[model samples]
Target: MSLYKTEAIVLKYYELKEADKIIVLYTRQHGKVQAVANGARKTKSRLAGSVELFTYSDFLLYQGKSLSTISQTEIINSFASLRDDLFKMAYASYVVEVVNEFTVDEEKNEPLFALLLATLYMLDRGEELELATRFFELRLLNLLGYRPQLDACVDCDLDLAKIDKVKFSSKLGGVVCADCALEDQYAMRINKGTVATMERLLEIDYKKLDRLKVPESTRQQLAKILPNYLQSIIEKKLKSLDFLKTLTMTN
Candidate 1:
């Protein structure tokens, strides 16, 4: 059996027979990986902490025909805060879910791995959840080649800044000007502020996200549009998304 090592973040996991677990992780070198952690469910298992959701860790694995086996693991960051706070956990979970849904197994995407780590760190530090989410959404889309045109009309070259009204069409994959609204009759009217907020989130460094204050209105608008836009890409809603909505609605 060949052995390998990688730095990975635990995306999710499932229980196995007795004291084992089947873990799903997104690695820096190898994109998404699924491995079995023998005895991980035991009290004294070293792999226990590393298998928790969102834990960043170094993994030693024995390659298997069906699924690799996690031979060893060392925790880099448990991201305790995300687990301690329900809201924060929900946000972090959503980002990881996005990563899992958009990526395939063993396809290397270091940028995406870094983005997930950064987003998790932001949530752990108690930063702006909505802004962080928007940044992750836009950046993730861009990295995956589904980048939506936020600068101008998706149909024409009409400058959005000079326009008084704009509409976002998931079908067209960007914002369309008023004149082009007829192109996608289902396009939803969008506010300039929301568009600008999305633009800033896409352009600004995530570290300086705090400097840009996002109004509740913009957040609400994003809550409506961005998630729907993202869901439109996948066609089926993510299970984590429904949980997130339930959490938000209850609180």
Candidate 2:
């Protein structure tokens, strides 16, 4: 029965009854929260626009025994441009969906929230969407304590520079050189440039992601492969990720 205020990003929502809506939000202080917004489905509801997916809002919430209730919400930034374009919206949805998948209730995840906000801002401003998405994925993995190794071989500790075809092993959490990968059945072929691109992405800031120059083939490869790698670790396919692919196909 205590009321609290916080800045939050609406991840997803669903209609609950004729007038109420259930909102899933990732807050700055509170990791991920599920709350019911009474009357939010009505045409004139004060929470209508503010509760939309991917919108950043300042919310006044009341704690309940089961789920919290959002008493009021004010839009801080609608990120209106993200909604205006399909590419932006699709990528933004991917980011939100991944966040929703990785997190649980009432945990303070400041780093992840900041990364998502920065990523959404980059997507909204019309940056290179592909690069932004990949970068977001890498950074998100790092924040979640599952950072993949890119420096050297996990087995012999050999530098990967001299290798031609690097072996990326999900079991080992990164690239293992050709020699080391020989013994491991779980390793897969990873291009040198792709490995380099992944390393750069891990270190670069969101503001400079557009300046990166990765080839289309490399980008496509990473885009296809990285998610599968992540899925191995995360143990589930994100629904929004599938929707994003479908949106791209139909467009």
Q: How close is candidate 1 to the true structure, as a TM-score?
A: 0.94
Give per-candidate clash totals: 0, 0
> Which portions of model 1 show Cα errors greater than 4 Å?
none
Alpha-carbon lDDT, every model: 0.89, 0.86
Number of the top-ranking candidate, with lDDT as the measure = 1
Give me the displacement of residue 187 in model 2, in angstroms. Answer: 4.0
| Cα lDDT tens digits for candidate 1, 96-174 | 8888888889999999999899999888998888678889999999889988888899889788887678889888899
The window of 10 residues in a row where model 1 has the poorest summed lDDT is: 157-166
| lDDT tens digits by residue: candidate 2, 1-251 | 99999999999898899899999999999889999999998899888899988999999999999899999888999988887888898899888988888899899989999999999988888878878889989998888888888878877778887666787877677888878887778687778788889989999877777788999778867877677678778788877778787876686
RMSD of 2: 1.9
Model 2 residue runs over 4 Å out of place are 179-186, 247-251
Best by TM-score: 1
